[model samples]
Target: MVAPRDNWVVDGLGATHEFDRLHAVEHRHHHDGGGGELHARGRTIRDVADVLCAAPLDPRIVAAIRACHALGCDLRILSDANRFFIDAVLDHHGLRGYFSEVTTSLSRVDADGRLRIAPYHDFHAGTHGCCLGTCPRNMCKGQALDRIRASTAAATGGKKQRLIYLGDGRGDYCPSLRLEREDLMMPRKGFPVWNLI
Candidate 1:
């Protein structure tokens, strides 16, 4: 018999709790927490995974990502989504191997023992301030991209490599701006962030 569908992410707090529970279980099974994701995206990991699996993924996009991986280019995912969910989605689409690393905010914690979403002033001024705010882990896309660049540089004998980022949301803005000429940034159609740069 088919099991009943579980909806763990009934609310924001429920989502967070779900992530924490999964992480705890995974930690016990692996017996090594260091190798897993550092940023936590929600309260529970499975809740995040459920949402991703329920969503429809584009096969063409998956193929493109796989092609990039075949070219010896690393496919790294930096998103606010919880690590478990994101990773599961990739695996479900047979694209897990494409990504060299995956970073999610659900894996990191702040000094206050909560998610660390950076508080940065907008380009305008104090009046138009915007904070990424506290996420599940310190796993903001900008920060993850920064970490990826540094790690790649270290691994590739300090060679500066190009970056390609794509997103359909406001969260993609800050990270895209950080890319250089060699890098590529793609945003969804009608997103104001795309026009700003």
Candidate 2:
């Protein structure tokens, strides 16, 4: 799954080294309600988005998206990022309608416009038996890909469809392994997944 674009979060925030530090803490403490400290810092989700969402959309990616949509490629987004952030980016570029599906961490804006995000699978409330060592505990992209394939099969009367997965992270490795012989995996060059392969 693709997290919020790096340009919006990391570099845009001028905190290149802070992402791992921040994300690691969040992942570990999320189930334990350890995020109270972060909120106590007076930095709400809205505040972050207000700054990061101002990054200009990449034209090359936008052109590619339009081309794929025009060709009826059945586009979808599988992202680790929350919907609020993804929607904000998509809405900024008027590209929200281009995708048939967007699978991500669920999010909603509270009455006060604070973004509340939840894991796609509640890792704390119930058991999620991934059995694979490669994925984040909150959600497994391989399982998610399997579900997407099942859904598409149901939609198309059980016809087999080839898939093309493009990703750039260690969490993405699980889904890459799920690809069949006929499917394609495009790992961004020099990224962790590519290095791993």
Candidate 3:
């Protein structure tokens, strides 16, 4: 995760960083509920699209994504970020063609015009067996990685592909543990995962 900079301010999307523009939404309503319930009014998908389109993409990363796609690599994104934001970013950068799959939090606009965000997997429903409690209740990246591996193998006629994980947050640590010796992990050098490793 990027360290909090002096210029960083909390946006309506509840993000404190400048680069995370995907979470920026019009916060016209707010709510506090027990047991992971959120009652905040949400912006529409169209609103999110506007914010994401205006967000800048790193040219280097865009080039890299294109190169990976040209090589026929099976690119996937596993993120705790909301799907709307992730999708918008990919579309904005013209990098959507590079990724075969993207796993992220589910986002939707409710009838009351509230943006509802929910986890892809609810741990409260049942544990994912992550020995480390570092991950949030919404997801366990380790488990997601296992499922991805299984599906990838199944899709490729039981031939396992070499895995490469790139992440920066503490949530990434659990998934890193699941990687085999042949796999590669690229954690941001100064981020929590890299420091922990």
Top candidate by TM-score: 2
Per-candidate Cα RMSD to the true structure, in Å, reads 10.9, 3.5, 6.6
Residue 16 of candidate 3: its Cα lDDT? 32
Report the lDDT tens digits of candidate 2 across residue range 132-188.
Answer: 676666678888899999999999999999999999877689999889999999998
Q: Candidate 3, overall lDDT?
A: 0.64
Which digits, one per residue and each the tens of the lDDT, describe model 3 over residues 1-197? 12121112124334334223322442211111111122232435465456556554567877887888899888898876656567667776667767889887676667765546667676447765677976655678888889999999999999879998988888889999999999999998898889878
Which order, best to worst by lDDT? 2, 3, 1
State every prediction's TM-score relative to the real structure.
Answer: 0.59, 0.81, 0.75
lDDT score for residue 190 of model 1: 77
List the lowest-lDDT window of 10 residues for candidate 3.
Answer: 28-37
Candidates in descending TM-score order: 2, 3, 1
Badly placed stretches (over 4 Å) of model 2 are 1-39, 55-57
Cα deviation of 74 in candidate 3 (Å)? 0.6
- The number of the candidate with the highest lDDT is 2
